[model samples]
Target: MNASPEDPLSQRPSRIRVDLDRLSHNLRSIRAHVGVPVMGIVKANAYGHGLVPVARHIQAQGVEQLGVAFLEEGIVLRQAGITLPILVMGGIFGRQAVQFIEHDLEVTVSSLDKLRQIEAAAEALGRKAVIHLKIDTGMERIGVHSYSAAPFIEAAVASRWCELKGIYSHLACADDPGSPMTLQQLERFQEACAHFERIGAPMPLRHLANSGGILHFPQTHLDMVRPGIMLYGVLPDPVSRRTVDVKPVLSLTSQVIYFKVVKAGNPVSYGATWAPTRNTRVVTVPIGYGDGYPRGLSSRGQVLIRGHAYPVVGRVCMDQFMVDIGDDSAWNEDEVVLIGEQGDAAITVESLAQAAGMSAYEVLVGLNLRIPREYRYS
Candidate 1:
């Protein structure tokens, strides 16, 4: 294994390196392709890419708005000096409505009660709360039902303290372009907007395209587009990757901190799940389920070292894991790649997700706060 005497990265066992240039490129590419304003999704710590830093980078790239799942996330961006428009996309409790106006964050009005609460808060605060009306076309998780959204829209449009800034719906199956449900949702959204026009309600900026919809359904790109995973250079599904041109922005890497020899028949890790048939070189990496590396990966995971792949031999511990590198004389401080290129070999997030029996979104967002994030550009 290649070793560096004075490499600073060798001091930390694991970290996530984020490529800002690629992130900016992806944002620009998506905007150019969609030809509309972009709302960069920065929820879940920017999907584990470091929320504030990623948001700052995206804001510098001239994105029109930022999206987060919680009101607290929007507050964080505002506290970090982000002045761009921020919309909290998740359903909110009525009590949290005041924070939206206080922080100048946009609210997602999912129900009439929530809208009334926001209006009340805005009136009491003497500030208008800008909002995006969320309609539930098929995804039953959040949003008002499309067929039942007329009153919601009318109330917001007529409210004196609420600014109806936009109307949107989540795409349930945009990853599968052939899925008829996407078309059905689109029809429902379009019809709902038409209803607003029929009643002479000022048509708010309409948006329905997410990363998947942006790639598979250009017609759904109304006034603005919200690109979440694609902004991080990951497609919502493998099939979408065939048509979307983007690059992965984050790489999980580590260094071998301990190495030893294990004798034949000796079991490894928590459950004694793996045993060596012969003498083997066992290298310990200081990362585990505690660091957001999936414990389910356990014996099924692989890591790249010195341009080759090695099997993880045991249950991934809370703060460390073991890899049997065979008899390869790999030593401490050797580079270990868990989700990035190593010489001619590489481990993509998709591969890691498959090994862990999880989705790519989970793999990315699940990366814990323990690992430091190193940012780079160019």
Candidate 2:
């Protein structure tokens, strides 16, 4: 069924359906595989699957904690009445540390200065600020350098108002089990942990495995594991797909709102990039780059209609695109599958990413909020 006529989602021609049961199953599978507390990564609007709903669902499934990229994201979850421990995994501005304390959000300490700011914020609030110290094993995007992490760890340990809750480092290449860099980063993180132990500092909860690490490097699963994409049933890397058993949890779909026949030699859409070689039937779907469908897929994209594959034969516009359905007669409101299975055919996120010259992460998170997400539990 497309949608009931009274359903608000049906009012929009395009929507993303999220299977929460599949999400829960993925979480169970991941937790079983890692045998550790899972800190569900719900950042980027739960990788564009819907943040609060996803977070609430994961929490209900017994997730010990949640991770978000920014303090505001954490605050949003808090405002939604989520009481689960949430860690803000992004870099923090010194002035914003108080919000972390006030909201009871765990802060990520990447530098000594940020640590002091958090300490002061906690002191002023008459509360303790829980934090995870991020060490730069690789990815160089954030976190203190592992070799130079002692001072930061020492400061965190010494702080009266800041509680060192955990220590973590991001993996740069855990997706490729064959890459020695992951092992190298693991060693560096271990050395940093040893430094903490040698200083007689309380060793905080240690975690280093992301989705890729959780699937490929079992040893990296320490006190806990932070999984993002895999929890949504998408592999962190294509190679990991062979090693893990999970289902895709999201499907982008739209309804065919208009259909017409194009005479041979007539151009299809803007820029005149494609023309029908023979008189054929074409259908317009109410989805485009404006809906986070990649514009790059313009002429290269494919969609499923009536269980048949149809090529997206024109430049993807701001709000609509056309597909050549051959000579088959199509009518308004015909179901179109953009990133899901239809009969024997399927178009996956990975395939769409390849067509758009982007990553699966990009394709998932790039899904604009304009497309309402409808939840399903079966």
Candidate 3:
């Protein structure tokens, strides 16, 4: 790890280091591939990459718009002095409409009911609500059904208080090559676009390509693209194996707080689930379930020390876990990397997710807020 020139190792214990340089490269690369207005998705704390910092950095790169899953996330960006246009991917609820309008944030109207509520709120505020219509496409989650979309679009366009700025849909199976659902969704979205054009409704900014859709489909890149996971430097799916050549922006590092030796047949950690069949060098790390390292990782997980992979040898305790270094004397009170590169050997987020039986998205976002995040450009 590169330390600050002024004060090397000034404050070090446990931290998540974010590589701003890598983030910039990823954002630029994804934008080049999409060839359209790229809205950086910063929901779930920028998919656990630290929201405010990520947003500010991406915004500096000239990303015009941002998307978040909740209204509060938009507020956080606004509070952080981010003046870029932000859209709440999910629609605002009853009481949230006022807050959304107050901050000049855009809202996605997923349901007619949500549009009605937004209309009521807009009427009270005496301002037209800038809304995006989320079409069901094939996801069948929140969007209007394909067969009934025409009527819904007509109603929305006719509303006096609602200004439809965009018509968007989400891809459900773009990551899975075997799933033909994406093609169907694309056809449905194009159909909706055609309807809007035929009816003389302003062709709102049409966006349907998400990260997976942009990378896998390419043909679905409409007016705008939302890149979330790709911004964090990982392939969208296992099959694509067309590695996104982007650098990982997050590195998890911790110090060896203490160490000990266990005689043969001695057990370690809770439930005594792990036993040292032979004498072993045990190292304790100050990280556990509360810190976002999945509790389920217990004995199955691995950590890196001196560029070597070591087995996690016990039930991961609340705030600590044991690593059996196997009588190796190369380790002591030294820094260790639970996730990220260590020398030539490295542990990718994919490995951690596999060990914990989680998707790469979950692994990144699962990192709890308790862990301090340190941002660096070099």
lDDT of 2 by residue, 165-228 (tens): 8999999999887889999999999999998779987789999999889988998999999999
Error of 3 at 115 (Å): 1.6
lDDT of residue 186 for candidate 1: 94
Candidate 3, residues 79-191: lDDT per residue as tens digits? 99999989898755788987888888888998788888989999999988888998888765787877678888888899899888888999988877567888888998888
Q: Which TM-score value belongs to model 2? A: 0.96
Candidate 3 residue runs with Cα over 4 Å from true position: 1-12, 330-332
Against the reference, the lDDT scores of all candidates come to 0.90, 0.90, 0.83
Error of 1 at 112 (Å): 1.4
Writing each residue's lDDT as its tens digit, candidate 1 over 1-378 gives 112446554456688999999998898899889999999999999999999999999899899999999999999899999999999999999889898899999999999998899999999999999999999999999988999888888888899998889999999999877888898999999988887878987789999999889999988999999999988888787667445578899999999999999999999989888899999999999999988999988899999999999999889999999998996878788899999888999899888998999889999999987787788885
Candidate 3 clashing pairs, residues 3+ apart or interchain: none
Per-prediction TM-score to the true structure, in the order listed: 0.95, 0.96, 0.94
Clash count for candidate 1 is 0
Angstrom error of the Cα, residue 28, model 1: value is 1.2
The better-scoring model by TM-score among 1 and 2 is 2
Clashing pairs in 2: none
- For model 3 the TM-score comes to 0.94
- Model 1 clash pairs are none
